[model samples]
Target: MNAFIYFPVYLVLKSEEEYAVYYLPTDFQSPELFVPRKPLSDQAKRAGWQGFLYDLSKVPQGAFIRIV
Candidate 1:
């Protein structure tokens, strides 16, 4: 049998928008660059870092949310 695992991701784009939410696969090296290529979700700030956790995934992909 084959096993599968998924990691949820929350990230911020370089534009005016805040961040994006998606899922990433875990068994192999991801070919995607974590770029928001299309229409991103509307900005909604949860209280005190809520919802999914993307800490590890963010570091390698470098999807940190910077306020500019």
Candidate 2:
């Protein structure tokens, strides 16, 4: 069996009228990992911090993470 890592991501949409954010969990490891090239934008960087805080509040204890 293959193991997968699910990363919680925040999708931020900015429009002239308003800004919206959505939280989603995505499987980080898969056969299709190398094909797509989706990089984070500057706005994402700002939103990421907020997203992280949100995820941390909800994630259960003892979750393993590696920092590089």
Candidate 3:
């Protein structure tokens, strides 16, 4: 089986003085990636980014896994 889903790549910055990271729209990059699909939290929905959620458990391994 073949399956695909789209997700926005976030450019997170680690705080120089803290362990926290920051996610901002101004910082982003284009990269091919595959990850588990899950529901977006209510807080994330307010971010206004577009994405889709799909169960990929049935998809065969190596079908979408990317190796660098």
Candidate 4:
């Protein structure tokens, strides 16, 4: 069996863009996954930033597995 690890992510908003910042442990490894989705809307992107703080509070730190 394979073991899985999770890293912390911070979503920062710059203007109307949402950026995902990943926080990893010293031994953390990056995943090799690809996304198959369309892009996000301008409004949705802005909202993502505005709600980042709230979302972080609810989710476990370093437990963010994925983002789209």
Query: What's the lDDT for all of these models?
Result: 0.38, 0.43, 0.37, 0.39
* C-alpha lDDT of candidate 1 relative to the true structure: 0.38
- Report the error of model 3 at residue 11, Å: 2.2
| TM per candidate | 0.18, 0.34, 0.21, 0.21
Q: Residue by residue across 8-39, what tens digits does model 3's lDDT show?
A: 32333456674433332212222233343455
Candidate 3: deviation at residue 37, Å?
14
Runs of candidate 2 exceeding 4 Å displacement: 1-3, 26-68
lDDT by residue (3-66, candidate 2, tens digit) is: 4455565657788987777554454323343233344466784443321123343443433232
Q: What lDDT score goes with residue 39 in model 3?
A: 55
Expressed as tens digits, the lDDT of each residue in 1-68 for candidate 4 is 02435444444445566655444342333333212244455678454332111223434455543343
Could you list the CA RMSD of all candidates, in the order they appear?
A: 13.1, 14.1, 11.2, 12.6
lDDT of 3: 0.37
Q: What root-mean-square deviation over C-alphas does model 3 reach?
A: 11.2
Which ten-residue region of model 4 has the weakest summed lDDT?
A: 48-57
lDDT of 4 at 11: 47
Span of 10 residues, lowest total lDDT, candidate 2? 48-57
Worst 10 residues of 1 by lDDT: 46-55
